[model samples]
Target: MWPGGTVRDVAGLWDVALPAEAVRVPGVSMAGFRSRTDRFVDMQVVPYPALTLFVDFGDGRVVDDAGSRWMDSGVVGLAPGGARGRGRSIDCLQVRISPLVAHAVFGAGAEFSGAMVSLEELWGREAVRTRERMWEAGSWQERFAVAREMLLRGQSEGPAVDPEVAHAWRQMVRQQGRVRVAGLAEETGWSRKRLWSRFRSQVGLTPKRAAQLVRFDHAAHRLAAGEQSASVAATSGYVDQSHLHREVRAFTGVTPNAVAQAQWLDVDDVAWGRGRAGARRLRVG
Candidate 1:
């Protein structure tokens, strides 16, 4: 069974938190996850609103559903939001970088949408050097400082995303993905076709898909909080409980009940329990 504020099974458990510098970067938040023991995290990755970067500093390896890539120490794995993977005896610092900030940092936000690639592919050998530095750092605070400097330097080099795309994305996030695409077009003074073309080009997912992801993220956490599925469905803009189920399944390949007990969501309370956004905890029996 799952314990409060932690995700555990045969794979063991992890402790998580956000560093102080994480708050200064817009569209960037870092969650430090340290394994309680040498173990694995086997679960479908619950999609989030940002690019997930794992800076591994532990023993063993991590593999995802899509391929045979085994991410080990001195390796940096990049899973675009929504990509699922597996971790075996993993201990690392996980950073969630919003796609909005991604373009400015990685210089290629559109390339990562719905895909998983190693940070080495994008950052090249710099990925190797950074991982080495992280491992050498004496403490989490020093490690976090190294990470912040690298990202901030990268952020200084690239062009920003279009203001229109930023505005549309902001609306989708603010409404918890409940807003209509046509309304976004109208508000941006762009035709529906134009909005669709541009949003997809820059943001990766189409406007509709992005909104669905945002909605599912909010509802998944609510369900984990022990809210009844039917109640969550009604308030989450679903036509019915079945609609919520289908969406949840589509996003995570799991039932609403399973998502409520997901190890991925369970760790949020402990790892992200405090810091920039404060703590979000839910009791699970």
Candidate 2:
């Protein structure tokens, strides 16, 4: 809502650390989004063997998967294979990946093309399903341990850079309150044009847009916890109330209050937030 658009009163997205060792994320959300009224926008229903990463791809209006680029707002997303009054809307663990991490694990040049293939291979279907099963079987601690071993401390590695972009980005999340494209380019010594090209080839969105998404996510996190608009805006780094509304509408497609009332998001929730999909083999010096 700040400089871009659609700020809400309160919004929230959830993340659960599944048992790392063996887990199978059931398609509980698919069942919940049965009616057309519950449909979300600009998302890809990327399914894994056990659990699925409900990534908020973008305003289905802008990103044209078929066209392979951004388009119009009238369009949004394709419906999943199933979703009736049976259960709940799709949800996910608010996870994210960085360009540096992918380059380090998959191989430097892999990021030039989509890095998702290698990630899918790294966290294979069987392993993914196993992780899900483990989650359903244990306490939160047990689930976290499994996830830590399997994901956090497993084969995952850092990105390839003198100064890790992933580390820098996490800082950006904390300090800048947004991942500014121009700033990243300046820090990396890449021209804005070069930066955008490389970023799109790898992460999907350009830098400024990605930063906005990250910012929106921060606000959504606060809102999800039942915070008020004024506090949410301040904590999330928004300038004020109007800014919040603008940002929320552009991203969440709902207001802060509405988002507070709602608990889950489907394909469009995080909108290309954390579902960029790239993990590399552990690389050492």
Predicted model with the maximum lDDT: 1
Candidate 2 per-residue lDDT, tens place, 27-131, comes to 111110111223442232221111222222122222323334432111111111111111123222222234343343333332333212322344567455644
Off by over 4 Å in 1: 1-12, 21-24, 73-88, 273-285
Q: What is the lDDT of residue 171 in candidate 1?
A: 97
The C-alpha TM-scores of every prediction are 0.84, 0.46
| After superposition, candidate 2 runs with Cα above 4 Å error | 1-125, 128-146, 152-164, 202-204, 225-227, 234-240, 264-285
lDDT of 1 by residue, 1-285 (tens): 112222322224455545664334666766666656534456556777676667766553445555555565322222233344355545567777776777777765445576666768778888888888888877666666777888888878877878888899999999998999999999999998988988876777788988998898889888887889999999999999999999998877779998887766766655544211323332212
* Clashes found in each candidate (C-alpha, N, C closer than 3 A): 4, 52
